[model samples]
Target: MTYDIAIVGAGIAGASLAAAIGARARVLLIEGEDAPGYHATGRSAAFWSETYGGPDIQPLTTASRAALQAGGFLQPLGSLHIGRPRDAAAIDAFLAEFADTPVRLERVDPAAIVPGLRPEWTLGVSEPSCAYIDVATLHAAHLATARRAGAVLATRAPFHAATRAADRWTIETGAGIFQARVLVDAGGAWGDVVARAAGVDPIGIRAYRRTVVQLRTDPPAPAGLPHVAHIAGRFYFKPEPGGRLWLSPHDEAPTDPCDAAPEEIDVATAIDRFEHVVDWRAAAVERRWAGLRSFAPDRRPVYGFDARVPGFFWCAGQGGFGIQTAPAAASLAASLLLGEDVAVPVDPARYAPGRFGR
Candidate 1:
């Protein structure tokens, strides 16, 4: 059967987009893995921080907050952007950057909130709007919503090739061949690859590996410990329910698309960085994993059709902010795809695929 739109990737980007499109169009959600979200979406250390993807991404994140909260996917956890004494300039810059934005930012004593904080790490910027996202639930809900709206999900359907003829696209995948009026490259890390296979120009989407380690600390992390991140982007850590701590070195090493794994050096670096921030001792390394975060050349999400490729849409390059901004991003992409009015207040032209030029 010919679908109105075929989305190549059943991760957050594809699933959320499909959910947003709803019954407005006949949709096909394609997944290369045996199940959807087996890649980046599944591996994300999910958190909703308005300042995560920088100022450009904040609008989408802010716009998505209501929808996410309404769906009961957000749990208030707050966030603290901590800095060392020498990072006073960075602290000031952070505040000045978001002064005009709705995101509430305030200065605070790091040690007061984050116990055992090193003396030198005196500066702190509190973002009270930060929260933990129920990623698995959110992803599952999107897929369910889309399915309920009559979208078909084809698992293990690795897109191999596609040829545009007339007004339809003949898409070949591992599952089988299908036809769709519009083909969306929501393949996450493999987005560019899908675009290339479809004879469309790639948007230079590059994937980077981010490492996270779950550690059992000597003093048992406090449940109230907010998500703590270094101003220098050296590391970030937050408390887990069982007195464990989730930490990341904030490393963005460029790597080819694949099942990413944490490097020993990266793990060690995270522990070393964590130690420097607080007096807490990491007693055991419980777990370590890595995920790929793809980004466009300008580090902004691409959410519109390719200007040069007919019936081809670009819905990738969301980086690490995809989960937090999914609702708004999906709304924007759906508007563009279905020729509807922009659902969110953010300017669609900013994230348009045309920004990269033909």
Candidate 2:
């Protein structure tokens, strides 16, 4: 049978888009893994910071707040952008960059960097409005909404190939042959691979591996501590349960698409970075994992139709902001899929696939 829209790769991008468009279209969410979000969405930092994606992404991040907060998926946990004396200029640049946005960031003095921060971080910026996102809950809720609206979700249905004819896409996958009026390439790390299989040229979408580790601190991580990141963009850490802290070396190594695993060197680098920012001892590493953060050449998400391939939608290249900006991303994508205008004022052309040229 044919569907109005068939979304490939049911991660946050696919799942959220499915939910958003299900009400007005016949939606089919196809996932290669046995479950949705087995990749990046499942291994997220689980935090929602407006400034996480830089200035270009703040609009989407800001637009998603209302929907994310509707279900109480956001937990209040402010953030600290700590930096050294040499980093003062970088801090000033960051402030100037987002000065017009709604995100609240204030100057943090050396004395204000307390609550366990090391002395080396002499200058900083603090955002009191940031919070931790309940990713598991958000993913589940979106999938459920899609199902309730009559969207079909197929797991373990790895997409193989596709051919377009007479405005219909005949797709082959592990499940079976299916047809769709519009094909959405939300394949995450394999977005370009999927586009190529669907007879579209690759748009230079690349995937990079990012590593994170959980460390046990000697003084024990306090529950009241805010999430912290280096102003120069080297590392970030946040409090975890059982006196542990979630830290990352913020390493973004170029890598091929696959099930990502953390390297020992990356973990060691993370611990070493953490030690420099805090006087507390890192007792031991409890857990470590890595995930792919896919991105376009310009580092912005691509969320429109393929200019060369009719009926093919490009909804990939979410980078690290996929979970944080899910609501807005999906809404914008759904609007374009349905040939409607977006609720937000931001132009969709900024993320259009046409920019790459066919």
Candidate 3:
């Protein structure tokens, strides 16, 4: 059956976009794996911070807050950007960077916010609006919403090739062949691959591996502990129930798109960095995983139609801010996809795929 639009990935990007446009068009949510969100969406560390992904991305994150809160997907969990005396300039730059924005940031004592913070790590910036996102629930809700809106979901459908003829696309995938008037490349790390196979010029979307590890610390993590991150982008950690801690080195190692695995070095680096921040010791690593974060050359998400390919849309290059910004990003993409008025506050031109030349 021919669909009005066929989204090539059923992760958050595709699922959310499908939900946004499904009511207005015939939509198909294609998943490469047996289950949707088997990649980055499933491995997200699940936090929404307005300052994440830099100022260029803050607009989308801020715009999405209301929706996320209304859907009950957000729970109060503030964040603390901590730093050492030597990082004063970085701290000031961080503050100065978002000074013009509506995000609330205030100076605080690092030790007061994060218990056991080392004496050398003295400065802190508190972001009260930061919160934990119920990622699983959010993803499921989008999929359910799409289904209710008459969107079809095809699992195990890894897109292979596509050919455009008479302004329609014939798409080849693992599951089968399908036809759509518009084909969307929301394949996350494989977004460029999808574009290439669809006979469109790739937009230099590169994937990087990020690692996270759960640790049982020597001292049980405090329930009230805020999400702690280094100003220098060295590490970040947040408390989990049962006295566990979720930590990452903030490493963004460039790698090819694949099933990402936590490297031993990265896991070790996370623990090593954690020790310097606080007095607590890592008793054992309970779990470890990694996921890919794809980014355009400019590190901003790419949306809208491809400049060189008619009826081809891009909904990729979201990096780590995809989940937090999903609501606005999806709305913007939907508006572009359906020829509707843009509802999101952010300017769509900033994320337009045409920003990259063919």
Candidate 4:
């Protein structure tokens, strides 16, 4: 069947774009897994801090607040950054950079760090506006909205080949053959692979492995505790729903695109980092997993059409901000495909794929 647009990968990026464009065009949303969000989108830390991304991405975060609030997917979980006296300079720089954003960060004394924070952390900052996102709920909501708007969603439908003729493109996939006038590559870590298969030049996209572990803690966490990150983001810990603590070393080791598994060494490093920074001991590790965060050579998300391929579009290289920046990113993609002007507050030039050529 022919579609107006065929979106590869049904994660946050693809799903959001599908939902946005479904009303305007026939969208075919395909996923490799049995279900959507089985990869990085399912394993995110679920934060909505505006200070998380670089200058190029901050405007998107700012513009997405209304949608997030209207959808009821955000909760004020708050975030705190703690560091030793030696790291004060780094902390100062962070404060100065985010001073004008919606995120309200305040410097606090060591004692004011979370109630049980280790005394070793003498300098701290708290961002009251930072919040936790309900990722699964948000993803489900978008998928439902897209399906209701007449978009076809197919799982376990990995694209195998693509060929373009005139203004149309034909794609062969595990599910079946499909045709579309436009193609969106939102395949997360497999973005480069998909582009190459579609006869487009790979855009130097790289994936990095990030590991997270859930641990059962003794005495549980004190009430009102906020998500805490060590200086340089070497490690981070947040309260989980079941009185558990989710921790990560914030490691970004370059990795090939594949199903990632947590390395023992990475888990051990996370444990050590947590132990050094927190007063409470992590009693037992209950579960562990890893996900791949893809980025371009410039560390910014690449969006818009492929310079060499007329009907092919790019919406990859989101890195860790895929979930946080979904609203604006999807809107931008839809705008580009529909030949409409960019409506989101983000500058199109910063995220355009053509930036790599310069």
Candidate 5:
């Protein structure tokens, strides 16, 4: 059976695209893992903050809010961007930059911040629109939608190779042979690798490792401690159930495609940064996990088809913003694939793979 589309990497990117593509075409969603989203999507920071990805990506994030809430994928949890006196100028610039955007930032007085925050954190802003994302729920929903729409989802099916001939692609995988007219490289960290395997030129996409550590705090982590993060990107922390605090040092060290594991230094650095931000002492690291956030050289997401490779679509390089932007990102990608107007308001050209000289 020949499918209209064969998408690699059944993470959020692929699943969401499959869902968006709907019953319009015969779609094949493939994942090498035993289950989908074993990488970035499953290990996401799992928050929807309009300020998370800067101005270029805010449009996608904002466009996804309605669908996220309507689908029961959002939990009310405000975000806090705390700044030190030294960060005054940076904080001011951030507020000014998003003044007119959908993200609403209210200046926070230092005295009102969480009790344990250090005195140096004198300036802060509260973006009340921010919310915790129910990532697993959302990912499952997208996969379910795709399945209900007749998209074939094959897991534990590692892609072996692909060849294009006579206007169709013959794909070899662990499961079996499949033929598709078009292929979507939603391969996450291995996006470039997938492209190369398909006889398509690589687009220079790279993956960076992000580490998250769950800490057992001395004072017992507060349940209502808004998603607090340093404006300058030094660190971020949020409350987890079980009185633990999820913390990251904001590390973005470049890494090759692999099942990522947290480094000792990364974990230590996170705890140290957390100590500096608040007076609460970390008693022990309850657990730690790492995921790779892939990106193009310019850091914006890369979408659209390869200009040089016919029937090849690119839906990679979403970085940490993958799950949060899935709704709009998938809509935009599906539109490009099907030759329709993008449901999202942003211009698609900026994210096109051709920008890399394809």
Candidate 6:
């Protein structure tokens, strides 16, 4: 049978897109893993902050607010950035860069911050617009919605090859073959690989490894503790459930696309940075894992129809903002494929794939 759209990689990007398109098109969602969201989507820190990405990405973040709230995917958890005296210039630059964004951020005195902090942190900037996202629930909700809307979702169906036939493309996978008028590539770190396999020119998407560690705290879970990050963002710590804390050194080393693993050095660096910032001792590491955040050369998402390949579309390179911006991004992708009006508030120029060719 033939489908209107065939989406590769059932991560947050693909699943969300599938859900957004709904019954407007016959959509086929394929994933190589035993289940959906088994890669970077499943390993995300899952925070929704309007101040996170670049200026161009602000519209997407703002546009996603309503969907996320209506879906009950967000919780009230504010975020704060702490910096030392020597880092004043960097913090000032950050505040100035994001001043026009919707995030409610304000700088506070270092002495005022030291009282609430663990005594090690000094200067601080707080944003009330930040919140925690229930990532698993969000992913599951989208998948369920897509299925209910008559979308075909196939797990463990790895795409092996693709060939254009007339106006449609035949895609062969381990499970079966399917034909579609349009193809969406949301393969995360392996996005370029899938594009090349389908005879599409790669847009130079690079995957960078990011390592994170979960540690068991000594006493309270720090549930209400503000998500903390230094001025340079070399490390960050946030409260987790069950008396645990998620820590990361903000490591971004270049890596090949695969199941990423944490390096010992990265873990050690995170621990050292944590020690310097807080008095808490990381007695034992409960768990450690790594995931790749794919980026375009310009460090923004790529979303548009392939200029050379008529029916091929690009929807990868979300970096770490995939979960937070999924709703708007998916809406944009669906609009582009269905030739419908852009529903979200974001401008097409910021995320268009053609920008890379210029």
Error of 3 at 322 (Å): 0.5
TM-score of 6: 0.96
List model 4 lDDT by residue over 1-358, tens digit each.
7999999999999999998886899999979899999999999988887777656677777788789989998988888888998998999899888777666778877467466667778888887777889999999998999999999988888889899997898998999898999999999999999999999999999999999999887657666678888767799888888788889999899999988999999999998898887667889999999999999988889889988889999999999998888988899989988999889877788889888773
Pick by lDDT: 3 or 4, better one? 3
Query: What is the Å distance of residue 11 in model 3 from its true position?
Result: 0.4
Candidates in order have lDDT scores of: 0.94, 0.91, 0.94, 0.87, 0.91, 0.86
Task: List ranges where model 6 is wrong by over 4 Å.
Answer: 110-120, 219-223
Q: Give TM per candidate.
A: 0.99, 0.98, 0.99, 0.97, 0.98, 0.96
Using TM-score as the yardstick, the better of models 1 and 5 is 1
lDDT at position 265, candidate 3 = 98
TM-score-wise, the better of 4 and 5 is 5
Instruction: Count steric clashes of candidate 2.
Output: 0
lDDT of 2 at 128: 88
The list of candidate 4 runs beyond 4 A from truth reads: none
Backbone clashes in model 3, listed as residue pairs: none
lDDT pick, better of 2 and 3: 3
- Candidate 5 Cα errors over 4 Å, as ranges: none
TM-score of 4: 0.97
lDDT of 4: 0.87
Single out the weakest 10-residue window by summed lDDT for candidate 4.
110-119
Looking at model 6, residue 70 earns an lDDT score of: 96
Model 3 C-alpha lDDT per residue in residues 221-242, reported as the tens digit of each score: 9889988899999999987889
